[model samples]
Target: MTVNSISFPHPVLGNGDDISDGSISPEISFQISDESIRVDVTSLQTGHPDFDRMIEAGEAVWHLRVQCPRTYMREDFFESGSNKTFHLEGVDFEGLVTIEVSLVTTTTLATYRPQGLHEDYGEEKFRLGRGEVVGIGPRYQFLIDKIYDPLKAPVSSIIRIEEGEDSEGPFTVALDTDLIMIHLSKSDYKEYAGITDRVPTVIHSALVLPVLADAIRQIEDYAESTLWAARLKYLLDIRDIDTEKPLQAAQEILFSPIARTFREVNMRLDKGDD
Candidate 1:
């Protein structure tokens, strides 16, 4: 079977408000209400453990941002408010088609709002608060650029796939589950790809493979533990597979190490580390 669309399911970053991901909610757009642009999210009480606890606390702040395809950051913070509606009218939303979501903790919410301050975040001299950006799913160079450690985090910067459809919900990895490589059939690919018009043969081209492979290699170069080295090897093997099943193979390779680290390293969940 031919590979179609690809998805990057973001791993949960934190225990509470420190996590924010695009898969929680679909692409939310601004509704023109009189002189204001009204942004609304429909996904509620998703039962995702990471977000559910924070939503229960009533101290979480949601941030919305959109970026252009060509330019990594051709968008800005439009508005911010409670977990519901965001109103803004300053920047142009024309080229900024990709929407990203950030769920900041109570500590971050009180310190900084996501609007007007978008520019400040870029050049802020002092340190800023911590949180997670579940916004925008993973894209090319995503793992190479950064691989999140569920252990430590002040904030998370997620990937937005340019090739995937905005309506195709974010790839979800269960809090209790670890990403594993599955020899996906066309049916599985369809499930991941969702309903898209174009059939992409491969997500990681020849040029992209080496870069990703190199990144995974670097992780092993410095990994002190034998288990870590073995885990990293799985990742490297997946990268070189060069089959139509790149996404599936990579996820398993990516997730196996995570499962090992979390299960073996520490009782993060039991101790409430987020």
Candidate 2:
């Protein structure tokens, strides 16, 4: 199977029939050859604020669905009558895909009822709503991520460490226990910071802090039983106390600065009290 060519529609002009007069038409085409598949999307329309407001205030949503070729079933792949699939020999199967295009237009209407004098036309609308705008950014990011890393594995799986310039084939090396320990230590600190930043201070102190404290106690017990005194000592030296204690100390350090800033702001506001 092969696609020969693709085309798109031209801009459409309206003579006061609808609000979308003189707006660009949305069109897209795809050409599939033996080597690659090429897609051409033209005149993709974007909506304005009014179109957004209308969508938000309306009940219906626009949906587009593309059907797959029937030959996809005979390509030694699974098939579903209700769903679409694409398969290529010696390549991974592609699933059903749909592309949506929207256009936005702004127009000024001439007032006929209010005499011949011209008045300021103030009509603002969004062809695409707020939700649509917010959704588009994430969708594009997802497409980029997929194109770059289709398998979607962790970074370690794809990266290769080499000795010198001429090294080629994948080389395996013994894991450095010390490096692993350091990485884990840094990861724990980042996780602690993130949780402290997001959780409410009151709840963190009353609930989360105690839970973390208990977990640290368990870790201390494990360290003692396993006779890993050196590792335990290294962990303790990093923070004069155990994990939870150091986390609490770091939180205190962060909180004090915030408190001081708040106090200064309040003092200034009090001096200008009204």
lDDT (0 to 1) per candidate = 0.35, 0.30
Error of 1 at 74 (Å): 6.8
**Per-residue lDDT over 12-131 for candidate 1, one digit per residue giving the tens place of the 0 to 100 score:** 332233233323433344554324445664443333454445556644445555443323444344223334555544233321233455554444333332222223235333223455
Q: Tens-digit lDDT track for model 2 on 1-274?
A: 1111222121112112123422323444555444543444443332434334433444212222232221132222211111223323322213222333232222231221111111222242223222231111001100101222222321122122223332233223222221111112343444445554344343334433333334344443343222222233333443355355645543342344345545655775798841
For every model shown, what is its TM-score relative to the native structure?
0.27, 0.18
> What pairs collide in candidate 1?
20-134, 21-134, 101-135, 136-159, 137-159, 180-252, 181-252
Off by over 4 Å in 1: 1-23, 27-38, 68-83, 87-91, 108-129, 132-274
Q: Least lDDT summed over 10 consecutive residues: which range in candidate 1?
A: 137-146
Residue 111 CA displacement from its true place in model 1, Å: 21
